[model samples]
Target chain A: MVNWIGLYTLTSREVGRFFSVYRQTVIPGLISSVLYILIFGFTLEQRISEIQGVSYTMFIMPGLIMMNTLTNASSNTSSSMLQMKLLQQLPDLLTAPLSGIEIALAYIIGGAVRGMVNGILVLLVGVLLIDLPVHDIGGTLLFLFLVSWAFSSMGLVMGQIAESWDQLAMIQNFFLTPLSFLGGVFYSIKMLPNWAQSLSYFNPIYYMINGIRYTILEKSDSSVMTSLWMAVLLTILFTSLAILLMKSGKRIKQ
Target chain B: MPELAIQIKDLKKSYQDVFALKGVNVDIPKGEFFGLLGPNGAGKTTTINILTGLVFKDSGNCLVFGKDTVSNYRFTRSKIGIAAQELSVDWFFSIENLLFFQAGYYGINRIDAKQKIDSLLKRLGLNKKKNSKLRQLSGGMKRRFQIAKALVHDPDILILDEPTAGVDVELRHELWNYLRELHNNGKTILLTTHYIEEAELLCDNVSIIDEGKILKKGSPKSLTEDLGKSGITVQLTQESIDKKLPMLDLDYSIEDSRIHFSVKNPELVIPKIIQELTSKNIAIHSIKTETSSLEDVFLSLTGKSINE
Candidate 1:
């Protein structure tokens, strides 16, 4: 039997850890996302006028929200696990009456919550500043939740793989952060050269942004079905990989 | 009635090219206070890790509560609690929350977890600092909180892997009292420590390991008696005492400016040597007796000092 109580407890602890440092994990993402929306969406839209039949401001808002969600989601799990590893506390959790799947799920759920909450907070910032319009509210929320789960799962995997702080930061800098910006958060794929646009399709974060954009603006640069399927696929793959690494005690064992 | 709380049958684990545990076998019975003595890199922590599911075993098997640790891991883990050498508590969480969450990991309900956390905090003398963040607490307090986290679940067995490392004597003594009380109540405990005195004082049975192999296994008293012999040292006023080796009457030698000899009974032989030295006009500075202890047994068996 799965220890439901133990799973809940581990999830609670993971959630509580980020909550314990809300000012660092939550507020910073919300502030930075809001600033991006203001400087790029509102200020630049005046000169750019419109993109793809919608105001540039509207087109960019979804991307900003997606970026923040993925970043926060990924950072939440990675930093938490990395801190536990460095502090030598992972053994405590390992010794608990918890299974590998339970541990992975707890971390994934924790990261998802942070990602979604930060995503919503950024959306709220856009709603107030750019007067953001929601084309489909339910789809927007669903895409946001799914994207959160996927990136958070990715973060758990990265956290397990990275041994030190510098290593984790390197992954974020070289991969997550750069790929996020290149994924069309600030520029539409159509605005890029054909070569860059094709490459953007390969960037996983591009699909995340495009999926969220389709939910909000009811328009997508790529096939909506493809974006949705990729999101689901990545979530399952990363989540399963995280659970496998944990079960094998890869780099997690004393 | 199952006699064993934990059973290891040729348990083995290796990392890359180094073997941490190589076919080590041990059986710890219920309610027994067992000590695992080893120098650094001798597989003590690795053994505990495998038992707790933190690390995978390469070969052989480990069982707790008569259940295989690998096949029935969660259930076996539920029966065990471990306080590791490192401070593993999250720095952001308060001591109270850390303990409460730890209890919950054992499937304890909220109300019972709270009660258990409160009681453990008090026993560890951490009630006043329950709401304090871990980073704010002193080293000793952190050590105590680690123990509190381990005991929060009230597992059938407790494994302490250097729980008192770098702790002060006062706090160590306090923890000893609490652990003794727990042991007296029929709780099985397996302790691994560098402190031979601590092992001698608390452990009923001990196994000393070196290079991932068990060198000696027995009670502290019996192991010392088997591996080491008592010696009498007769201090002399002059640097040379070689002439008195024959007069001392029992195969003695002067080495390092002192006359010394192994004796079955130091009480009987020490006095006779002192009297003989004084009557021979040899000024005796002081006479001392040395008895075998766990350290001596460990040194004799391992051929290396634990302190080194």
Candidate 2:
């Protein structure tokens, strides 16, 4: 049988590592989310007024939450792995009785926790600033959990393949940032033309944002069912890719 | 039979087009202080990496405590502690925090991990710096911390890759003394170093590898004795002694006021060499006698110096 005690200890260490660096991982993201809310919600509210049926502030709250969650989750795993690698402390983990699954799970879950913390912090801040209401607390929590898990796995994969600090930054700059922005973080698909809206349907982040929006504001650009299924599918896809990369140990083993 | 802590058979590894290990074989019995001796660019680090499961091999097999390293990695790995060649501790973490995290990685509870961490830091002379961040510690202290971290798990085998590379002589001796104590306590140690004298003093058995191949493998005494029968050195008061008359029946070179020579037997040839030199009225200042060392054997075998 696998050692649950060992898994828990490792997972705790991973979580603690990120928590210790809250300034870089958590606080900055929270501050940025608040800034985005103030600037986009109030400034743009005068021009656009409302998105779908909800106020612009409420419409963008879910997007902001998703953006913070995904970025935090990815940064948590990537930074942790890179630090372990650079410090040469990764050998300690490799020499342990823990399997690749255990290692991957520890990192992914650590990222998820950080993501959730930042997401909740941002949401709480949003409530204070804009009076946002939760239409479906259960669905919102579920979407937050799934989206965080998916991005965290992606971060782990990125960490393993990255050989230098520059490579790690490249993943964030080139792939993650673009995906988050295009994932409908700032604007709803309903605001787009028919063709652009159809294209947004393929963006996984769009589903996560819309799903979260449906839960929090009860007004989404897409159906709740479609968003739920897309979130689940993306989670499975990203998790499998992460696991496969970790198992191969291609760039990591050296 | 004593249990073999590590066994390798025809192990081979390659990186892209460069082969790192070529059909290398070795057996390390439990509780022995073994040294993997070689100069830079040799396969010493590669061998350690393979043993620790940080790198994969192209072919051959390896077993740790009789468990296959490839198939039974988790179990075997749990019994091994590796202090990598590079200083690999998180610079952002405090010394105490690093140890606690390492202990946790091995599944130790917080209560038990605290005890182990305290004892290790004390033994390593790092208790005062427990709260110091890794980046703030000196190089020697960082190296010692790495060793302390490795030992937190209390594995049966301890692999130290050049643990004393950048440390001063005193700290190096302290480190060696600590390693000796660990060996005395029945821990199987696989050490790699460029210092031949260090290997000669601490290792019970050694393997010299070069260019991804084992050049020689045996106990230090056996390998030294097998290289050549004996050696002799004659110190002269003047460097002009060689210009006065040609020395006979021996090949010698004057290096730093000393004339050194190698022979099958120093006792039988020493008297003749002395008489031959004296016949020309060559005045001698001092003389010394010795046997071949691992350095000599390595140079003769690999056609390259250990420090090369």
Could you report the Cα RMSD, in angstroms, for every candidate shown?
Answer: 4.1, 4.4
Pairs in clash, predicted candidate 1: none
What does the lDDT read for residue A217 in candidate 1? 83
lDDT of 2 by residue, A74-176 (tens): 8888888887787676777777777788888888999999999999889888888888898888898899999899999989988887778899898898877
Residue clash pairs of candidate 2: A87-B88, A88-B88
For candidate 2, the TM-score is 0.90
TM-score of every candidate's chain A: 0.96, 0.95
Model 1 alpha-carbon miss at residue B83, Å: 1.0
Over the true interface, candidate 2 deviates by an RMSD, in Å, of: 1.9
How much lDDT does each candidate structure score? 0.85, 0.85
User: Each prediction's TM-score against the native?
Assistant: 0.90, 0.90
User: Against the true structure, candidate 2 has what lDDT?
Assistant: 0.85
lDDT of 2 at A170: 86
